[model samples]
Every structure is written in C-alpha cells, then in structure tokens.
Target: MRIALLTEGVHPYAQRAGGGWCRRLVEGLAEHEFQLHLLAGDGGGSGGGGGAGEGPATYGPATYELAMWGRRPAGRGPAAHRRRAYVRAYRELVRALVLPGERGSFASGLYRLAELTRQDGALPAFLASGHAQRVLEREWRAPGADTAAGQPLVRDVLVAGDLLEQCLRPLSAPWYGPGPGRLGAVDLCHVVGGGPAALPALVAKRLHGVPFVVTEHGLHLREQYRSYRSAPYRWPVRALLLSFFRLLTEETYREAAVLTPGSAYDQQWQQRCGADPARTRVVHEGTEAVGREAAGVEPEQPVLVWAGALEPGRDADLMLHAYARVRAELPGARLLVYGEESAPGYLDHCKAIAERLELGEGVRFAGLPESTAQAWAAGTVVVFTGLTQRSPRLLADAMLSGRAVISTEVGVAREVVGPSGLLVPPRDPAALAGACLALLRDEERRARFGLAGRLRAQERFAVAPVVTAFREIYLELVSHWPAFPAVDGADGGVPRPFARPAEYWVAGAMAEAH
Candidate 1:
C-alpha cells in the first residue's frame, strides 16, 4: 500500500532528536510504499549552533522537504476579480481569528483561503501584500472584536500577517490531485505530527477521497500555547497567531479518521480539542527493549541518573537542590547527569546552580551516554525533573533497563510509571528528595520496582507492538475507503465515517436460530 507520512521538524532529515521514530516506522513497514513529507523550522525561536548532531547519514529517497520560511517564486499576480475574492477570504479568516463570536467561521474561511491559494498560487505574496495587513487591521478594529487588551499597531499587523502566511503555506502545496504519485493516489495519509504538519494531510483528504490518520506524540496546540508565552511577538500578534493554531488544530482533530495519541495524557488533550472518543486510540511511543541480563546488574554505589537535554525547562536546578538534600542524608549518594546542552549555556547555568546549592562531588555532569542501556545501568534510580516532558522516552528506556524511576508528575510519567516507580510534583525539591531517599534507602523496594518496570516496558513500550498497531490501523482505514463523504465546494464539511450497526442483528438472528 502507498502511504504518505507527513511530519514537522528536522527529524529523520537530521541526526538530531535521536534518529526519530519516523525512520523506525518506515523501516519497520518496508514492504509498503512510504513517502515522507517534512516541514522544517516552524517555532520562530532564535538559538545558536544547529542545536544537536549533523544531518542524517541516510535520508531515504522518498523524502520531500519544505522549509517554513522558504521564499515563494514571483507570480504575475492574480487577476483583478480573483484579487477581490482573496481579500474577502483574508478578511473572513482574520475575522474568525480576532472575534470570539465568529469562531465558527474559522473552518469555512480557512478552506476558502486554501481554495483561492490552490487556484491562483500566490498565497504568500498575497499575505505579504498590504491587502492582508488591511484585512487584519479592519478585523481587529471591527465591532465585537476584542481590542480591550490593546489596539494593534502597524508593526503588529505586519508581523501577524507574515506568520499566518508561513503557517498556511502547506495549503498551496502541489502535493494534491488524483493522479498517481500524488497524495490523492495514496492508500492513506498518516500525519506523524500535529498542528501545521497535519495541514497537508487535511488538504489531501479535502481534495481527494483519501482518509488521514493523525498520530500525536505531543500535543502540538499545547506546545504552541506555551511557546507563544515566551515568544518575542507583541500581544496582538500572539493573540492572532494563537487563535489560528487553536482553530486549525481543532479542525484537524474533528476531521481525522483516527487520532493516535502517543500516550493516555496526550489522548486527553485530543478529546479536549474535540477528537471523538470512539475514533481516538492511545499508542505509546516505542523504544527498543533492553535485555533482562543488562537490567539485572545494578551499580555498586547509590547513584541517581538524570538523562535529558540540559534546557531551562528540564529544571536541572530543582534536581540539584533535591540531590543536595539526598546527599545530606546519604553522604555516599551521587547524582549523574547525562546528555548535552540543548539550549546554549544551559549546561554552565546548571553547573553554577549546583555551586550555589553547595553540592560538591555529589553532583557530576556526565555527557551523552554511548547507549541508553549504559546510562540506565550506570545508576540505581533514574530521575526526571522537566516541567513539561511530553513523550519521556528516557523514562521508558529506564524502565526497559530494569532501573527504578522517580519522575515529575507531568506528561506520560503517571501512565508510564504506573505502580512501578515513584512520582513527585514538579518544581518541588522536598518531595523529589524524599522520593529519592526512599528508593535509595530501600534496596528491596528498588529491585521490586525495577523488575516490574522492566516487565511493563517490554509489554507496553516495545517497538514491535507499536508497529503492529499501525499496520492494523492502516488496513482498517483503507478497508472502508470508498465510503468517504464527497468534498463539498471550498467550505469543506466534516467527513463522517461510514455508519456501522450498533448491534449485529443478522448475527444475533443466526445465534437465536442455533
């Protein structure tokens, strides 16, 4: 079967992000024809050095890359009549954005704009034009629009217009059409990421009869909300762009044939975003399971392992403070931090924090581990201190390695840890320290937790089960393909699945006869 895998970010194309699960999915299902659609660089944050490792050593031939900020080629510009429609569409789109009462116009306005872009092919130019800014200004100043916070200045309108154009670029992509080698020809459109990455899949399903599956490892809309809080945009720009993302994500969730959240935590977010409970599935992100032999051997010292990128959100400071308390009680206890700095100078910042806490030789920064098993084997208990960790792959790796875990009660920690380990509230050093001390003091408890954790990882998070689930999902969606509701004009209606009988009355009759 032909499958189109749409994703956002530099994963698979770059060595960053641990080779990414996309590569694994494609490799696991090598018998099927897979086409990759990647959107690079979306979060408009400024950072130095390409962050992590070099480009991927082997990017498959099926990959298609599009940069979020790539320049659009100059067009002769749309005809005069078409220009008016573009202006009206932009007006409606911005209207839906700024006014809460007009939220229902979002989907209609969005697809109308997409149709205009698909027909004329100058969406970026149109968005960057003065016309787009005027629409945004008028919408903001319109009656019922929420301008009580503050009126948007000229610069704010321009910035918001540019952002909107960048996000909507996928709608103008040439990947659609019913011809072979295009998205329409694919047996299924699988969106590997949420938000803008799903934009292409949305377009494909809208233009063609193809069904799309959305697999969300993290809640993209939630991430957008958090990121925009720290973003350098003005309030007006933030408000407008956030609304666009909010509405777009909701439309994606509502339209998806199936919503596969990487964990139960993310599944809740999907439902809150309007995903149908009957259509939603929780698929845990998988990792290679470590052998029992590797997990059975414990480190001699009472060591605590913290593995993750050394970024501000990871709250390394809290971990240091908690470890300081642990050292006071058990002077022999050690804290080993593994992984490199994701945000520049975060490593030095953590080191300075350790100094302030006066955690002498008890705390040590070990660079990236050669392998996950080695990292988990180097310590008796694994620790996580992030304020927000969506997938928490290292937590799974620790469980797979048969090591006891103590994680912040965030993201998938509760679901992943279950009864195998301990959980502490985020940013609470006293609670974290208490949990660590409890585990370190009791070797029997740690051993029992480790064994249980290993078993849980093997049963739940192993790669084979995850692949099998998708294999079945793909077939299930395609098996009922031709029943997809026909796409209505520009303002596409929500596609409904073919109805199934609530009760198998025919089979019931057969059973009654028997």
Candidate 2:
C-alpha cells in the first residue's frame, strides 16, 4: 500500500517511547509500499510547512523512524497573507467549540479558510506562520459559553476565533500535497493517534477525498487538557481550551474510515464521541521482542514496581501515595519506578509526594532500562495505578513478566490483566495500598500471576501477531490503489501481504531468538 503514514511529532526526530508503535506498523507491513509524511508541532516555530517526500524510506532490520512531527526552524521567517487567513479561520472554529454562541462568525470563517486551501497550491503561505502559539492562547481565552453546559465561556468569542485561525497553520501547510515537497499520494490516510498527529488527518479528509483510518494509542487531547489544568492560564481558560479537543475528537470519529483503539476501553470512549461501533476495532499495542529466557525468573522479595513514562497521567503520584501506606504493614516493602520522565514538573512532583509521605527509603527510582521486561521481572509485585482512562497499557511482555498487576479498570486493563491480577479504581491510594499489600504478602500467588500474564502477553500482544495483522491491513489498502508513486523506486500497485512462506516459531525457542 502506498500508505501516507500521517503522524504528529515522533518521526524524523527520536522520542523515547513515543514512536514505537508507528515504527512497528511501518516495519511489519513491509509487503506494502508506504509514502511517509511526518509532522512536528510547529511549537509555533519557523520551519518549513512542508518536507521532501523523497523515495522509499529506509528501515533498519528492527527500527524505522516514524515521522510524527516536523522540526521547528531556527529563525523567524516571512509571513504570508494566505497563512494569516487560515489562522483566523481555525481560531474561529476553536472559539465555536469552547464557546458555542460564537457560531455565526466562527462557522463563516472556518469555511472560508477551507475553501481557500482547496485551491491549487494555496497551502504554503498559510503554513509558514510563527504565530501558532499566540493563536492557541487567544482562543483559550475567547468568548461566550452556555451557562448550563458547565463548560467554558470566557471573554469574547470573536477574539478567541481569531486566535484559532492563527494556530490552524497546518491547514495551510504545503505538505498536504498534490505534488512533490508534499504529503504525497496514498491509498489510505492512517493516523497514528488523535492529538496533534490526527489533526492534520482530519483536515486531509475534509479537503481531499482521502479515506482516513484512526488507531489511537491513547486519548491524546484529553491528556493535554489534564496536563494544562495547573498552568498559569485561568481556570476558565483551561475549561475553554478543553473544547478544542472535545471537538477535534468529535471530528476524528466522524471522518475516519475506521477507528482502532489500542484497547477496548479506548474504543468505548471513541463511541461516546460519535464513532460508529462497526468501524471501531480494538487492536492492542504489541511489544518488541527482547531475547531473554522469561520462562523462569525468580522474584526474591516483596517488591512493588511501576513502569511507564513518569508523567502526570501515569498516576505515579498515586502509586507513591499508596506505597507510603503499604510500608506500614510491611516495613521491608519497596516500590521501584522504571521509565523515562515526561511533563515539566511531573517527576519532581512524584518525588515530592514520596518525600512528604516519609516513604523515601522503601522506594526504588530504578531509571528507565532498554529492556522493560527485564526491569519488570525484577519485581515480586507490580503496582499499576496510573490513570487508565487515557494512558496506553505498558508493553504486554512487561505486564506478563508478571508481578501481580493492580490497575484501575480503564482501557484494556481488565482484558490484559484478566483474573490473574487485582483491579482498583483510579485516584484511590487506599485501595491501591491494599492490593499491593495483598500481593506482597503472597509469594506463590505472585509467581503464578506473573507466569499467567507472561503467557497471555505471548498469546495476545506479541510483536509477531501485531505484524501479521497490520500486514493484512496494508495489503487490503494497497489492493485498492492502482500503483505506487514514481519517487525513489517505490513499485506501487498491489504490494502483497503474506507474499512469502511463513516462518513459524515454537514457544520456548522464541524468546531466546528475540
């Protein structure tokens, strides 16, 4: 398939755990030809609105850069009138979302920008603006809301609408190409997630006749709102900013040809936002294989561990709060955190909570490791209370390496953890503390849960199966497109999936090979 792999900022530049899944899709679907269009947050910077859509992308034996975001340019560039027009339109649309009463002008402005972009070569000047950040702020503080909806209705809708217009620079991006130095041609519009990456896809579907498929790893826009809650912006401003995403998600559900949430829980939320049940698929994120003998790994002590980015939403703070309580019952208990940090102050916030609880010595800040499963195998019990409503589950291999997982019943925790693990509600440290204490007290049960989780990860979320499934999707998409483009020798037409004889791996022998 000449797939236009639409992404926000993960590709071209390396982001720790962010680009893994998209890379998997690109590599696994080797049978299908793909045209990559990576995007990065303008971060309101001065970078090219478009990138060269060269030839076939190169992939190493294991990793490929998933172009998610475009890099910001170093200096200020010239602004174009065409770009300014789009900014106005987008801002107005955002104002409409946050403050519905501004509909008349916002609607009028949005269509005008869309109409302009539909013209031949009209995207460049608009996508070249440096005012995106300003636009974002402008709309957050913009106008009228329904008093009863309990959402946001700040100062003036027109001002906010203008701000959104400036921020909607990507709509003017030349990358959404009908030519070279553009997004290129593709059989399907495959969006990696629904935040910044999916935003471009939404526009492409609206402006072009492209068919879009959405596969959400997590709820991107929701996480953004949660992170911004404590920002310097007024509460009313935060409330208003949320309307931007609620509306973005709504658009995603409507335009996407198919919606695939990484977990069933994500699927449910997509439904709430108006996704058709038949179009939504629950495809779990699979783990890259690490060659290690996992059939037998000994858990020596009563330890609790959590693995994931140290972000606000990971619920790391809640885990720290719970650990303080757990240690009262078992003074020797330890909580180890192994993952990179995210968000400006989230890591420090978690550490502060640990210090305040006086549970300093009982915790382990084991830093992120290359092999998440190896890190997970070190624990006797895994304490997973991070917010599940939006965060994607940890690599299935890590979860399966077993430590009794105690997660909030969000996303696919119930399905992933199944009966072998304990479940808890989010934000409840007391319940989390109790679950950790139970697993810490029982060594044999921990061993069983770990093995069961390992087996399940192998059976359900392993890399091979994910590759197989995606290869199929690629073939289906490619079959519909006549041929690949001429750039860099990409032979289009039907890039066949299952084109070669399959190689099978028997159980125990597999981990050793990985």
Candidate 3:
C-alpha cells in the first residue's frame, strides 16, 4: 500500500525532533511505498533545525518527495475576484475560533478555505492582507465572544492575524488536489505529527474521501499550551493562538480513522482533547537493546547518569537539588549529565544552579557521550528528572542498558520502568533523593532490577513489535476503508480490491442464514 506520511517539522528532515522515530518507521515498513508530505518550518526556536526547504536531505531511495511549505512567498496580494469569498470565509473561521463552542462553524470555515485554496491557490496573500486584520478585529469584538472579553489591542489583533495565517498556510500549498505526489492517490494519509502537519490529511479526506490516520509521539495540544503559556503576548493574544490550536487539534482527532499515541499518557491527552476512545490506540515506541555487558558494572566512584536533551521541561534544577540531598548523605556520590543543550544558555543556567548549590565536582556536565553504550556503562544508576515526557528515548536506552532507573512520575515513566526501578513524584527533591539513595545503597536490589529491566526491554520494548503493530494497522485501515466516489475514473484512488467495503459479504451471510 502507498502511504502519504505527513509531518510538520518532524521527520525525514529535522535532525533533533522526532525524525528518528519517523525514519525508523519508514525504514521498518519497507514493503509499502511512502510519499513524504513535509510541512516545513522556519528553523528557529527550540527543537528547530534545517527543514526540507533548505534543500533535500536524503531519506534513502524508497520515499517519494512532495512539495514543502516553509517560508511564505512574496506575492502581489490576493486577487480582486477572490477577495469577497476569502473575507467571508476568513471572518467565519476567526469567529468560530474565538467564540466558545463553535466547532461546526470552525469545520465549515476550514473546509471552505481549503476549497478556495484548492481552486485558486490565493490563500496566503489573503491571509496576510489588511482585510484579514479587520475581519479578526471585528470578530474579536463580536457579541458573546468569550475570548473578546479581554478587549484586545490593535497590536494583539495584528500578531494574532499573522500567527493564524502561518497556521493556515498549509491550505495555500499546491499539493492538495488530484495528480501525482498529491493526496489524491495515496491509499492512506498517516500524519506522523499533529497540528498543522495534519492539515493536509484533513483536506485530503474531505476532498478525496481518503482515510486519515494520526500518530502523535507528543501531545501537540499540550505542547502548544506549554509554548504559549509564557509567550510574550497579552492574555487575549495567547488565548487566540491557543484556541486556534485547540480547534485544529479537535478537528484532527474527530476526523481521524485511528489515533495512535506513543504512550498511554499521550492517549489520555488525546481523549481529553475530544479524541474518540474507540478510535484511539496506544502504540508504544520501541528502541534497540543496548549490550548487557554494561549491566552490574561497578564504577570506582558511585555515579548517577542523566542523559537526553537539556530542556526546561527536563527540570535539571530539580535533578541538582536531589543530587545535593544525595551528596549530603553520600559525599562521594557523583551525577554525570550527558546530553546536547536544546536551548541556548540553558546549560549555563543549570551550571549556575549547580554552583549555587555548591555541587562543584559532585555534579558534572559531560555533554553528548561518544558512545551511548560506554556512557551507560559508566553509571551505577540511571536517572531521569524530566517533569514531562512521552516515551523518552533515554529512559528506554537506560532500561536496555540494564541499569536500574529512578525517574519522576510523569508520562509513561512508571509504565516504562515498571517494577524494575523506583518512581518518585516530580519536582520533589526529597522524594527523588530518597529514590536515588535507595538504589545506590543497595547493590543486590540494583543487580536484580537491572536484570529485570533488561528482560523487560527485550520482551516489551523491542523495535520488532512496534513495526509489526503499525504494519498491521496500516493494512487493516486500507482494507476496511469505505468505498467513496471515484476520482479520475479510479475508485477513490486507493489500491484495487480493498477500496470497496465488505457490505456484500455481510449481506450474503445474513441472507444465507435467513
């Protein structure tokens, strides 16, 4: 089956994002043909890097590449003929987004915009127009608008308008309609990331009757809330931005044929964001097993290792405080932090915290280790202090390395660690310190937990099972897709035989029984 893999800033291109998992999926499902539909972004802010627009970064020969939407083009503004309809559609879209409980309007307006774009390819200029700002301002002041209670300023309106335009820019892309490298020919539209990345798939399903699938490694809505929480904007601007994202997320969830979350935590978030429980499935991400030789190796100095990207959410300060408490008890104990700095000055901030705590040599920032296996071998116990995570790769590596873990109670850490390691509440230095001390003080328990962890990683977290699960899901979705109106004289442009529904067999069976 041919699948159109949709991603926004995450796969086949971005180095630091969830591209690794996406690359794994593509490589694992080698039997099926993949058409890459990338929603590229400007390489700025956290987790940002080179996108498809920076020229093609190789993802091997099996993938067919399509258009990438990154930087907006400089154009002569919206055409005169399309202005009226564009204004009307744009107004309704902003109204539905700003007002409370207007999903119907939101969906209609979204599709209307998609249709307009599909027909004329003139959405970008219209979205960036002065008329768009006027529509947004009018909608903000509309009666009974909950978000408008804040009485937004002109600056707020302008910023919100620009932000909305960026979010909706995918509609202006030329790849939505019929023909090769477009959404029309794919058997299934599987969106690897959510939010704007899923926009094309939504349009494809609406325009071509194609089945849509969403796999969220991270909760897009939750991440948006975190990102916009401290955004240097007024409450109304933040509200507008967040509300738009929420509406988009809900639409994506409601329309998806299936929702595959990387962890149960992510699944719960999706359900809370209006995903149907029956349609949601938990497909845990898998990793390769590191060598068992690293297990039970006693280092000269008792060391605790924390590895992964140094981000604010990782709560490195909490790690330091806990390590300080540990040092109070065991002065010789050392905490080795190994990972790349995700944000500028975050590493320095962590270092300052360490200095303030007077954990000079007791805490060390080892940066990215040359060999992951060697790094795992250097630690007596692996630690994860991140306040939020969805199937963190470092935790999986730690388990596979056969090291006992002490991770905060967030995301799927408990589920990932199970009985093999100790769990503590997040942001509690005392609790984290206690948990770390428990594993550190007991050699027998550490050895036993290490063995169990290795077994669990091999049994449950291996890459083979994840690949098999997705392969099955792909086949099932394609095989059971309902028949729809043909495009270009082809049956919904899906692979033959499976494009048609199984109603005939069911009817025949019932008739025979009667």
Candidate 4:
C-alpha cells in the first residue's frame, strides 16, 4: 500500500513537534509502505536547512530531501559559519511569499522565497544566527530588489514586514517538493500539519487522485492567530493575515478524505471552520502508557502543575490569578509552570499575575518539564486554563501519574475528565481558583479523581488503540472502494488516479444507491 506522508515541519527534521508523531505513525504501521510528499520549512526560521525539500525514499535505496527548514551550506561547518547560507535561503522564501496568482500560485510563491534566499538566507538561520543586519542590507538595497526609497530607510514598518515574513516562511513553502516544479508520486497525501501544509495536500489530491488526510496535532490557525495578532502588525494587517490561515484551514479540512485531529478540541474547531463531520475523527495523541510504572508524585501540599507554552491561548496568567485564590486557602501549596516563554510579554504576564495574586513565592517556571510524568508527578492535581480545548494531554499524563486534574471548560477536558476531576469555565479565574481550593482541601477526593483519570488514560490514550484505528481507516478507505489505478495518458504521462477526477469519491458517493 502506497502512502504519501504529507507533512510540514516534521519527519526527517530532528524536532520534537509534529515530526515525532509522524515518525511514530510510520513506525506503528510498518506493515504499510510510505512515500513522503513534503512541504518543507526551516527548523527555527531560516529558509532551507529543512530536510523537507527532500527525503530518503523508502522503496529500496532512494534519496530525496525531506520537508524541513534551514540552509547551512551544502558544505561542512566551521567555514563562514552559516552567514551566507541563510541569506540565500531567505531570498527564496521571500520570493515565494510575494508572488501571487501569476498563473501558478505555488510557483509564484517559490520564486519569491528563493530570491530572498539569494539575498539574506532562510528564516531558521536568520533567527537562530541573529543576522537581521543582512535582512536590512537586502530589503532596501538588493540589485533587483524593490524598495520605497532609493536608500534603505530601516523604517520600523519595513522591519515589521520582515518579521511577519520571517514568521510565515514556515507557513509558506514550495509544496510537493523543494520547489513547485517537482511533485512526488504517492497513493495519498497525509498532511501532518494543516494550514499552509494542507494547501499543498489539496493541490496534490486535485492534480492527482491523491487521497488527502490531515492530522492536526497542534492547531495551525490558532498558532497563526497568536502570531499575526501579537505580531508588531497593526489591526488591519493582523486581521487579514489571520483570515488567510482561516481560509487555508477550511480548504484543507474540505479536501481531506479523513481529518484526524489529535484531540477533541481540534475536532470541534475543524467542524466550526467547515470540515464535514462525517470525514472527521478525533484521534487522540498516542502515548506509551509507561507512566504506570515510571514515577509517582507525592507533593507535600496540594500541588498544581501546568506545563505547556506560556502564551495567550494557554492562559498561564489567568492560571496565576486563580492560583492566588488557591494560596489564600492553602498557604503551603506549590505550582510548577513548565515550558519556555513562547510569546513575548507572556512570561512577564505570568510573573505579574503571580505577583498580583500574591502567590509568587513558591511558583516556579520549570522549563519543558523533563518528562510528562515528572511534571505530573509534582502535582496532586494537573490544571489546564485555556478556553481552547484540544486533546488535554496534560490531563492524560496527570491521570496516568495518578494525579487528579483541575481544567477549564474547553477542549477534551470535559470528555476526558468527566466526573473524575473539577472542571471550570475558561478565563474565569474566580472559578478556576475556587476549584483548586476545593480540590486542595479534599485529599481523599483528589486521590480518587486521580485514580479515575489514571484508569481512563491507561484505557483510552494508549498508542496501540490509536494505531489500530488509523490502520482500519486506511484499509476501509482503500478497500471500501478502489481509487485511481495507474493509467497512461495521450502524452504518455500517467493520468491522475484510478480513471476519473479525484472529486468522484466525494461526489459520486453522495448519489450511490441512497
């Protein structure tokens, strides 16, 4: 069985994000064969360091660049130290973003980004290496580059555009392969990341009879909203950019033969944004269930653990506000905020909130909680404060560690926690605080809830069940009906899938014998 593992910022790239899940997915279903179709991006923001442009082909010994982001020179390091490589990658990335609807959308995008690469390099190198000076040099004075002034102004506005493009480079990549001209062959395009990644999947499914699958582990548009909204851009531009992510998300969901969101929170968003519920499934993020044997946390006081990006959507500040109330009730209580400062002003916000709530004493920002079990082990209760409910893995780990949870009413928390843990409405610090205080006061009740959550996590969130479900879905989609079989066209090119247009599966299925 041929599978096109369509992904963005994962796989071949050594990152702990969506790529990890794709690797596990492939490893799980080793029984099936896979061919990757990638839309690459830099690991940290440069243009071409990405393994995405090519990947090692799986059908015997074949070589290709996998989808990734970054360009550190084709040669080895210690010479020139990646200064020029990033400049070249950024030129290409900028070129890709600037060109629009000039016959080929993807091609137009490719050239724009490529030109940037030739100028200042890719996004990852630019950000990781701290070479914004080069961006200034090229943005205003490239030989063929367009600038408002005869000389580089270094205006704040231009800097804003530069930053916006820098952030979006990952969201915008040459699909199918390194560039628009090349698209690999695959049975289906399984988009590991949505939004920009999904756009290419739609194109692939249309150009070929490629069955498209979308797996959203982290919501792309949600991240984009956070990006454009808080970006230095003013109101109008932010709204417009967010709209782009929204539209792409809708189109991606519409094109997918199956839309598997990593959590129930994502599933709702997909439907809200126009995905067909029939085509959607909530495939919780898989875990090994190793926590049962690993660590067991026994915090002295009623400890609350919140580990994730300290950002707006996660609402760490609000959690702090609630914690102030909890401390009033339980003075010896402790809180561990795990995760790096992802958004600007977010870490400050958490600190200020902690100060105002006057619970700043024992609250520590534990970066990237060594392990889910370690994070969960620190708390008698794991709490989530976001209004956005994606799969609450924080709770899953807590449950697995035998810790009760206190989460806001958003995402799969209600479904996962049910009657086991205290649930509060999101953004309401009073309610969140009150729940924490209640849970702290009742040790026996907290232990019971923890036990229930642990049972549920072990029973449902285990990886095997998830792999089996996906295997069945794949078999059903394939054997339930035959898709395009290879056929040659008049020009000797292989005509796209089976024998008809790819739309037939969706359209023809609607009218068949019903």
Estimate every model's Cα lDDT from 0 to 1.
0.78, 0.60, 0.78, 0.61
Give, for candidate 4, the lowest lDDT window spanning 10 residues: 57-66
- The CA lDDT at 356 in model 3 is 93
Model 4, span 423-499: residue lDDT tens? 88888989888888888888788778877877778877888878898897877675544454432223245544433
Model 4, position 102, has a per-residue lDDT of: 18
Query: What would the per-residue lDDT of candidate 2 be over residues 1-514, giving only the tens digit for each residue?
Result: 3466666653222222345676677677766665555455443122343544232334222111222233322333323655666567656665565557664454355556656665543433333344544564455544554323343333433333333433354555555544432333445667776654565566655544456677777666556655665555445444554565566677668777777787877777778878899877777777655234563455565777788888876888888888888888889878889888877887788888888889867887878776766777677776666675444446355655655567877667777778767888899989888888877787788777777776777677777777786666655544443332423323344343322212322333686888
Q: Which candidate model has the greater TM-score, 2 or 4?
A: 2
RMSD of each: 6.7, 9.5, 4.7, 9.6
Clashing residue pairs in candidate 3 are: none
lDDT of 1 by residue, 191-221 (tens): 8778787888888777776789998777778
Model 1 quality (TM-score): 0.84
Better of 1 and 2 by TM-score: 1
Q: How does candidate 2 fare on TM-score?
A: 0.70
Q: How many backbone clashes does candidate 2 have?
A: 32
Q: In model 4, which regions exceed 4 Å deviation?
A: 10-16, 42-63, 66-185, 232-243, 289-294, 343-368, 481-483, 487-514
Model 2, 73: alpha-carbon shift in Å?
A: 9.3
Count of residue pairs whose backbone atoms collide, per candidate: 0, 32, 0, 69
